[model samples]
Target chain A: MLWEMSASHIEESQDVTSQDLDEKLDLLSLQCLFLMNQVISMKVDIERRMKEGTGMLAKARYVMGGSSVSTLQIPSEEAGMTASTLSSFEESERMIGKSLRLKYYNFRVFPSAKVKDDTEDEVKDGIEQKLSNLQLDPRQSQASNPLRWFGVLVPNSLREAQKIFGGVLLLCAECSSIESELEAVIREIDILNQVKSNRQQK
Target chain B: MSDFPSSARPGKLLAIIGDEDTCVGFLLGGIGQLDKHRKSNFFVVDKSLYPSATNIEEIENAFQQFVKRDDVDIILINQHVAEVIRNVIDRHTSPIPAVLEIPSKDYPYDPSKDSILRRAKGMYTAEDFR
Candidate 1:
C-alpha cells in the first residue's frame, strides 16, 4: 500500500511540473506578441505623421495657389485687398507652421527605436496624442493666398506651384510606404499560422 | 506702396538676379530678355566671385535697376541675393514692379528676412491665441 501511495504522489508532482511549464510558455508568448505589436504600431505612427505633414503642406500650397478651402480667389488686385492679404499671409504662415511643427514633433517624439520595453497600448496612446497635437483645425486653415498682391494671377504660375506641391506629397507618400514590407510579413505569418493549424487538425 | 499698378504700366517682363542654377532655371521658364541697352534682366552670380551674394553693392545695383525699370513689372530675385540688398529692399516702397524673393538652388526662402512679409507680420493687431 505504501508503494502505491508513493506512485500516485509522483504522478501528481509530474502533473504540477507540466502545468508550471505551460504557464511559463504562455508568459513568454505574451511577451513576444507584445513586442511585435509595439514595433508594428510604431511604424504605423511614423507613417501617419509623414502623411499628416504632407497633407498639411499640400493644402497650404493649394491655398497659396489662390483658392481657399471654402472660397475661390476674388478680385484681389484692388487696393482694398490689403486686408485680405494680411488674412492670407496669416494662413500661409500657419500652414508652413503646421508642417514644420509636425516634422519637428516627429523628430522629438520618435528620437530612436528603443521602444521595445514599452507595452503595445502605451506606444499606441503616445502616438495618438502626438498626431492629435499635429492636426490643424479646418476653420483656422481657410486663410486666403496673399500672392494676388503680386499679380501672380497666371494659370501657368499656379500650375507650376501645384506641381511642386504634388511632388512633395509624392515623396511623403513614398516615405509612408516603408512599413508595407514589415506589415506584409505580419500578414504572411498570420496566414501561415492558420494554414499550420488546419494541417495539424487534418 | 501704391494700391494698384498704374494703368500706363509696362508689364509682361520678369527680371532675374540669381545664382547660375536659379538664373538658368528662370531663363528656361521663358523670362530671358536682352534689350537695346545690352541689359539682360538675367544676372548670374558665380560663387567664385563671392559666396551667397556677398557682393552687396552688385546685388543692390541690380535690384535697384530692376525696380526702377518700366518694362519689367516683376523682379524675381534669389532670397540670398535679396539678403545682401536687404537695406535697399526695405527702403523700396513702390508697388509698381513687385519684388519677389525666391528660393535658390541651394538656399531656401526665409520669411524672416522678407521685407514685405515682415511688414505684413508687423501689421497684425490682434493677439494670436495659438
Candidate 2:
C-alpha cells in the first residue's frame, strides 16, 4: 500500500513540474510576441523619419543650388578636423525572466567631445598634428560642429535633417537590442517545448 | 548558455553600409571614423554617384570587411542594399556584430523581409499556439 502511495506521489510531482514548464513557456512566447510588436513599430517609425529627413535634405540641396556643399564635405578625409566624437556601443544587461539575464549591445554617443578620451595620445604627424591643434582653438566654435564641414552657413533644413537622422540611429539601436532579446526568448521556449515533448514520450 | 559570440571585449564602432545621403547624414551625426590605416568605418554604397556600373560585388566586399573587422560591433545596412546581399547576411550567424536592416530614402521597411521578424514568425505560428 505504501509503495503504491509513493508511486502516485512521484507521478504527481512530475505533473507539477511539467505544469511549471508550460507556464514558463507561455510567458516566454508572450514576451516574444511583445518584442516582435515593438520592433515592427520602431522600424515603421524609422522608415517614416528617414523619408522626412531625405525630403528635407533634398530641399536643402535645391536651396543651395550649384554650390560646393557635397564636394567639399568629404567626411572620411576630414577625420583629423572632426570636432564631434564618433558613436559607439557598450554592453548592457537586463533581466527577462527569473535567472534569465540577457547581455546585449547598447549604442552610445559622445557628440562634440563632451566625453574626453584620456587614452587618445597626441598626434605627432605632420598635417594631422596641425589640424588637431586647429581644433583646439577656442575662437573656432563653429568648427565644434560636424555640420561646419558642409558649409559656414548651412540651411535650416539640413540641420533638421541631421537631427532626424541622429535620432533614428538610436531607434535603430533599440530595435537591434530588442530583436536580440526576442531571439533569446524564442530559444528558451524551444528548449522548454522539447522538454515537454520528451516527458510526454516517456 | 553563451548566446552572444565570443567577444571578451566590448565592440567600439557602429559601421554603416548606406547610400550617399544616408552616409552623409549619419557621418554628420558624428559616427564616422577612420582608423590609422585610413580605412573608414562607413562604406558609401552609392550607385548613382559612381555611374560606372558599381556592382553588388563592391557592396558585398564592404559588408564582408565590416563583418571581419573586430572593432565594428553593429552594421547598419539599408534594406535595399541588404537585399542584394541577403545570402551573405543570412549566413552571418554571430550575435556580437549584429546586422540591422534599415530603410533608405527610396525603400521603406517591410516587416516580412526582415530577417529577425521572419525567424520570430516561424516560432509562433497558428499551430504552435494550438
Candidate 3:
C-alpha cells in the first residue's frame, strides 16, 4: 500500500513540474511577440509618413508646372528661353531634395546586421547552424531581398512601396534576433522540466 | 505650442550673429519671439539690432546674456560673425548649449574651411607617430 502511495505522489510531482515549464515558455513567447508588434507598428508609421511626403512633392511639382502655363507672355524670344531655363533649374533642385530624403529613408530601413553585403549570407548561415546545434525548431527565414517581396505584394506603386516594405523587412530581422534569444532560454527550461519529470517517475 | 518641462526645455535665448539675409531666414524659422504679451522660441540677437561699429563689446554683452540663460539648447552664429567674436566664443566651455557656426545664405559651406575640423586635425597630427 505504501509503495503504491509513493508512486502516485511521484506521478503528481512530474505533472506539476511540466506544467510550470510550459507556463514559463508561454510567458517568454508572449514577451517576444509584444516586442515584434512594436517594431512592426513603427515601420508602418514610417511608411505612412514617406507616402505623405511623396504626395506633397507631387502636388508641388504640378502646381509649379501649371503656373508657368499662364505666365507665357514675353517681349523677346531670348527672355522666354532664359525664363524656361530658370524654371527647369528650380525643378531640378526640388527633385534633388526629394531624392536625398528618399535616400535617408532607405538608410534607416535596414537592420544593422544586413548593412554589409559581404557578410549577410554568412550571417544567415551562422544563425541556421546555431539553431540546429541547439536542436531548436527553426522559424521560416524571410527572403533576402526586400525589393522582390515589394514587387509581389505591392505591384502598382513599386518605388514608394519598396521603400515602405524595406522598413518592415528591417523590423522583421530585429524580431528574428529577439525570438532566437528567447528560444534558447525556453529550451533550457524545457530540458530542466524533462529531467524533473524523469526523476519523479522513478 | 507644446509646453516642455522647464528642465527638459531648450534654453530660452538664441543669438545669431550673421549677415542681414541669414538673420532674416532664422527669424522666419521662429528662433526668437519673446514679447511681454506673447510666448517666443528664442531671444534673437543679430548684427542689425546690435551693430558691430561698437566693436566686440556690444556683441560680447549679447553673447553673455544668451549663454547665461539656462534654457537654450543651441546657439547658431554665421562663420563671418564668429570670426569677429572668436575669443568670446572660444571662452565658452559650458556643454549645456552647443554653439554651431552656420553658413549664411549667400555663402557656400566649405568643409575644408571649418574651424572645428581644423582644430581636430591639428590635435590628430600632434599625436601622430613616425
Candidate 4:
C-alpha cells in the first residue's frame, strides 16, 4: 500500500510539473505574437507618414511648374513668379528630405536584424550616403535648380522610410513592446485558464 | 490699419531673395513682379541679380518697398538671404506682412539649429520648462 501511495504521489507531482511548464510556454508564445503585431503596426505608421510627405512634395512641384509656365507673358511677373515658386518647392523638398532623414537616423539607432534583412540595409545606406554627397556638392550651392533638388530629395525620402521601418522593428524587439490586440488574446487565455482551474478545484 | 488677411489685399506680394535654387523655388511658387494694372499679389527679388556685397542693399530696398505698399502681405526669404538683410528684418515692426526665413535646397532643415527654435528653447529654459 505504501508503494502504491508513493507511485500515485510521484504521478501527481509529474503532472503538476508538466502543467507549470506548459503555462510558461504558453505565456512566452503569446508575448512573441504580441511583439510581432506591434512591429507590423509601427512599420505601417511610418510608411503612411512617408507617403503623405512625398505626396505633398510632388503636388508642390507640379504647382510650381504649372504656375511658371503660365506666367511667362510679362517679364517682371514671370521672373517674380518663377522665383517664388522655386523657393516654395525647395522648402517643400527640404522638409520632406528632413523627415526622411529623421526616419533614417531612427532606423540606424535601432537595429533589427529581421526587418533590416528584408529592407537590405546596405542598399539603403548607400542611397542615403549618395544623397548626403549630392547635398554637399558645390554646384548645388552655386546654383539652385528646383528640378534637380526634387529629383534627389524624393528618392532619398523613400529610401529613408525603408530604413525607418527596419528600425521600428528593432525597437519592438528590444523593448518587447506588444500590440494591444495580442495583449487582449493573452489575457483571454489567462482568464480561460483561471476558469478551468476553479472548476477543477470545485 | 487693415485687419483683413494679407491674401485679401489687392496687391499682397511675397518677395524671395537668395541663390539660384532659392530664387528658382520662390519663382516656381507663383511669386511674380508687382503688376500695377492687375493688383500685384506677390513679388520675388533674386539677390543673385546684384553683386554679392550689394545683395543686402537690394534686399533692404525690396523690403522697404514691399512694406510701404499697402498690398503686400508676406515676405518669405531664404535663411541666408535673411542673414544678409538681418538689420532691416529685425528693425521692421509692422505685422502687415509676416516675414519668414526658409531653408534652401542646399541647406538641410535642422529644427534644433533653427533660430526660431533656438529662441523658443531659450524662452523655455528661462521658464524652467526644459
By DockQ, the best candidate is: 2
Alpha-carbon lDDT, every model: 0.40, 0.67, 0.36, 0.38
Instruction: Count clashing residue pairs per candidate.
Output: 0, 0, 5, 29
User: For model 2, what is the C-alpha lDDT against the true structure?
Assistant: 0.67
Chain A of model 4 scored by TM-score: 0.29
Per-residue error (Å), model 1, residue A170? 21
C-alpha displacement of A179 in model 3, angstroms? 36
Off by over 4 Å in 3: A1-202, B1-14, B35-53, B112-115, B126-130
TM-scores for every candidate against the unseen true structure: 0.36, 0.75, 0.33, 0.35
Alpha carbon deviation, residue B51, candidate 4 (Å): 7.4
Which model is ahead, 2 or 3, in terms of lDDT? 2
Candidate 2: give the clashing pairs. none
C-alpha displacement of B119 in model 2, angstroms? Answer: 0.9
Kindly list the per-residue Cα lDDT of model 3 for residues A1-202, writing each as its tens digit: 1112334333443545556645653453454345345434443443443344334323433544433211121112221111000000000011111111000000111111222333324645532332222211111012322222212342233333223323322332333333233333333334444556576688
Query: Which prediction has the highest TM-score against the true structure?
Result: 2
DockQ of each: 0.01, 0.32, 0.01, 0.06
Fnat per candidate: 0.00, 0.43, 0.00, 0.12
What would the DockQ be for model 1?
A: 0.01
Cα error, candidate 1, residue A52 (Å): 22
